[model samples]
Target: MRATAEQLRALRQEVAGLERWQAETTPRRMPLGHAEADAALGGGLEVGRLHEVFAGHGADAASATGFAAMLAARLGGSLVWLRQEQVGREGGALHAPGLSEIGFDPARLVLGLLPDPLTVLAAAGEAARCPGVGVVLVELWRMPRPLDLTATRRLALAAETSGVSVLLLRVEAQAQASAAQTRWQVHSLASVPLEANAPGHPALSVELTRQRSGPPGGPWQMEWDRDRGIFRAWDGGGAALSGPQLPLAAHG
Candidate 1:
């Protein structure tokens, strides 16, 4: 027999309670599919935390942005990217077509061009609290003094409370103190050469500069495989160089 309204309500409550319990008990780290990188990242980058990526020079800004995009793609959800107007103008606006060529899905992206740091932070905080956003990326060419510990702490709390990942992209910024769970320094590396000496997958020389939970360690040479949507160790002289590189001139 079909259940009465009261019985159906009770069953719904039970299901909701079970889901909440599972979320609380399950491990939050989502693996990047690279064994070594995942191991160094404490089983993978943890969700609900603020992570920082620093670019040492103006040239490395592209590498940093690419790395952050790959991470957001790995998280497998819609992304919200916030950038101050000045940074956007200086670093070049994030081009959708260019980003898609690098493996980021343009359809899942939302861009916010704010006028100032405070506005950017405010937008990021609100976006982080939104359950629909999978990842929130905030770009800061220089971390303003106003974005002190309290501000970062607020960002961290928002991410944690909503179970979203936050990436802070700092271009040409000094490594100062912050409340980020982990900090990375990224630099562009020569991409693997494909058949006919073509440029292959994008590569980055990533160094783990800081970690709040464990000892930070890495100078890992990593590559992003757009086909597989995961990171892999840069194979120096092996199958990585044997195949033809994927073309970016066109896409489905």
Candidate 2:
């Protein structure tokens, strides 16, 4: 049966109203590690969705880990770091101080170097469904073929419903297209002086390679101070502290 013009118009209005309601109710903003990145990200990383950071092969894992830890820490919740390969042997364990400086409780953070990517994804989906977890970071070299868009969309929806943030950290060269909301490429920037004239530690330079909802190709830089176990922004003026200024939570 063909619908009349008035009926079609009414349906369109109803759909528009529903979209507006969803937009108003959805939690759409998160604090990115860097202010510039946040601006480029259209706010910050959107909560309740999957964001991908693709640090290409030969990319510095320390910097990538530090960046992820810093962001996760600010979000203030339990974090699960899933590694695709063995951590102790293949690469060094993720730097604990890097996360600590960002204010993540060591006890709340769970690190797992899984043998299978599917297992990690499954765990992330479950975590997203649960309210206990605040964020889940999955570090994988690649995604198995069978776990495609359907699987990812399921996770995304779960995150939305449960208010969890899922971050997928892929090795620089290996991160191919996926159903992620935002994708980034991170590189290590040269260290600067901690104080005026005093030498400072190195930091990470991140670029927003792709984003579903915002502009791409941002040269956002953030520094990880090993001694302090914290992350700060790197402005050309100096290594001044920038980004979200939330209080650091005490670690257990």
Candidate 3:
């Protein structure tokens, strides 16, 4: 049956109200530890969304994993680390000295050593659906098939609906195009130098390769204190080490 103009107008208004309510009610924002990183991420990592971290090479994988773990710790939720490939054997362990310093409780961490990428993805989705689990980290360095839109969309939808923050850790060499909300490419620079007044090691040079929503250039020089087990920004004027300038690239 054809609807009259008045009825159609009323229906449209109802739909609009629903849309507005959803926008206002949906919670989207996870706290990334670093202020700069959070700002760069457009108000932290969006809660209930899939975030992809692509490390340009093998060396960057550990840093990416550590960084993701740190972020998870700050969000105050249970962390599920899904190990893909031989990530378990190949220094995929999240026990960075920096983590302890940064205040991440070892007890709250849950580790899953899944060699199969598909299995890992499936489990991550399931964990996200579970109300108790807060964050799920899927390490996909050695997945057989490249991540494409289909897989990413599935994860993204799961995150959105379940209100879980998902981090996809991929090797830069292995990563292909994906439909993730945030595709971050990470590159490690040199470590930050130890300060004269302080009695510890310096920070590391972490370059932001790509950010989907925010400005990209950052030799975002950061420092990880071994003794303290935390990361801090390097103050360049002191004896701290400084990495090369990271120029932002045009959005892909």
Q: Which one wins on lDDT?
A: 1
Per-candidate TM-scores read 0.82, 0.74, 0.71
- Model 1 has an lDDT value of 0.84
Q: Where in model 1 is the C-alpha error above 4 Å?
A: 1-27, 237-252
Q: Which candidate order results from sorting by TM-score in descending order?
A: 1, 2, 3
Instruction: Find the candidate with the highest TM-score and give its number.
Output: 1
How far out, in Å, is residue 149 in model 1?
A: 1.2
**Model 3 misplacement above 4 A:** 1-22, 31-35, 92-102, 172-174, 195-202, 207-217, 224-231, 236-238, 241-252
Clashing pairs in 1: none
| Candidate 3 TM-score, C-alpha based | 0.71
Question: Please, what are the lDDT tens digits per residue for candidate 1 over residues 1-252?
Answer: 599999989867865865685467653897877777688888998886799999867899999999999989888789999998777567787899987987888999999999888899999999988878899999887758767777787787677767789999988789877889889999988888866878879988888888887888888889898888888888755555456555777656
- Residue-wise lDDT of candidate 3 within 156-240, one digit each (tens)? 7667666778888876455566657676666665554344434344344555555555666465666554444445676655654
Model 2 bad stretches (over 4 Å) = 1-24, 85-87, 95-98, 195-202, 224-232, 236-252
True-structure lDDT of candidate 3? 0.66
What tens digits encode model 2's per-residue C-alpha lDDT throughout 1-252?
598999989867865865575677956687654666777777677887787776644557666766677667766678987776654456667767655655666888887767777777777777778778888887766446645666767666666667788887666446565678887778877665444444466567888888887568667667654444444577645434433345688984
RMSD of each: 11.4, 10.6, 10.3
